[model samples]
Target: MKKTSKKNNNFKIPGTELNSSDAERGKKESQSNFVELLPLEVTSKIFSQLDIQSLCRASRTCTSWNHAIRNNDSLWKSHCLTIRAVCQREIDDDVKSGYTWRVILLRNYQKSKVKYEWLSGRYSNIRSPVSLPEKAMCPMDADTWGEILDAELEREVEKLQ
Candidate 1:
């Protein structure tokens, strides 16, 4: 058997060495934005499928993703409508006031959660603030409080009868 030369001792397995061509290709792949590869309509449709939490998490992953998510108001609109089921007046007011879907959602998300709990009687039996769920309270407008109060009264009436 022929012996290998010392000069050839630095043998790298084929394709193991990252040559200029490989480096350039890898760089191109990394630099290519997934959002840019697709048409905005397609990207919006794809992102529209993501849930609110998933959309939010994906937005934080990269600037491109964030831009793609932020530029599509329809994506936010669907989630806002889901919240509107719980806070109808609040959402309607915001929409009528010319607020963007994203802004409307951000403004009402926490309020909706707290309001839903109250309206659903989740907190109907609480005797004091100490008995409330931790982090369950949010500042809501008078209309929202009125709705909650009305719900509580209805619950009381149901109990009385």
Candidate 2:
């Protein structure tokens, strides 16, 4: 039978045993050192200025940030309103459906992107009705369709010039 040495038998897991220096380092690494130090109003104001992508990233950073972003419906409402300029009908539908501002934005953000691509003529061939996103056709009225068509025609005319 092989006998393990006493020194070898006593194993120290790297982080399980913390010396004074390690404890100090751990304290320094806490989220409260930065974000939590700010007043809630200040944090909300800062997050309100961030764009959708930045706000989403910030929400994932920590519990406090998530709470700040989630609880402030006005912040998400402002973003939803901004996106409404690009996809008004979709935003209206989402509002009618009783979705919260955050949910409304999530639901329409992709649809708005696709609609913008179509309006800007980013796709070379928007040939068939099937080629367009389902949501694009559903909520858009005849007037909105006319506007989109006019915009596309204007873009084509600009390209020709």
Candidate 3:
């Protein structure tokens, strides 16, 4: 007796079964590999999995992704502020509560008041005591950065001593 060819059977795709109601749902589900295609929330979860360097590099990959990461200013504001430690200083109380960063930037960089106002006012919410270097300020190199860290550590150790 000859066996029938399996291809002759009008059969359901073994793993492609759809319990979805609408054709659109079925089509979307079938075309989208649930295993591969993440939902937006899941995509964000995957993004958060990346290290800081990976995240920054990924942002430059394309326009849409870049927009997403860059627009999330609040997420990186703290990091930017902390790394900007050397630029920090306390402003005169008489000037204003949160003008420290601007004041330090202008003073350390010797920027004009007009340019200072232009640059500082661009940030939506800035530091109270000022953080982050001004545009004119030359960024500290790794050696200088290390020295600053060492000085800070020495001060901290001395305080505990």
Q: Could you say which candidate leads in TM-score?
A: 1
Off by over 4 Å in 2: 1-35, 124-161
1 or 2, which is superior by TM-score? 1
Global fold similarity of model 3 (TM-score): 0.32
- What are the per-residue Cα lDDT tens digits for candidate 2 across 1-161? 64423232232467697655555555555624345666777877888889999999988988877887887888899989987988888789879989999999887777677667767777536777777656544354565567678888887788899
> Which scores higher on lDDT, 2 or 3?
2
Q: For model 3, what is the C-alpha lDDT against the true structure?
A: 0.46
For each candidate in the order shown, give its overall lDDT on alpha carbons.
Answer: 0.85, 0.74, 0.46
Worst 10 residues of 1 by lDDT: 2-11
Off by over 4 Å in 3: 1-14, 17-40, 74-161
Model 3 Cα lDDT, one tens digit per residue, 85-139: 4333322321245534423333333322222332334322334426544554444
Per-prediction TM-score: 0.80, 0.59, 0.32
Report the error of model 1 at residue 143, Å.
Answer: 1.2
Runs of candidate 1 with Cα error greater than 4 angstroms are 1-27
lDDT digits (tens) for residues 101-148 of candidate 1? 999999999998998888888899987878877777877788888998
If both were scored by TM-score, which would come out higher, candidate 1 or candidate 3?
1
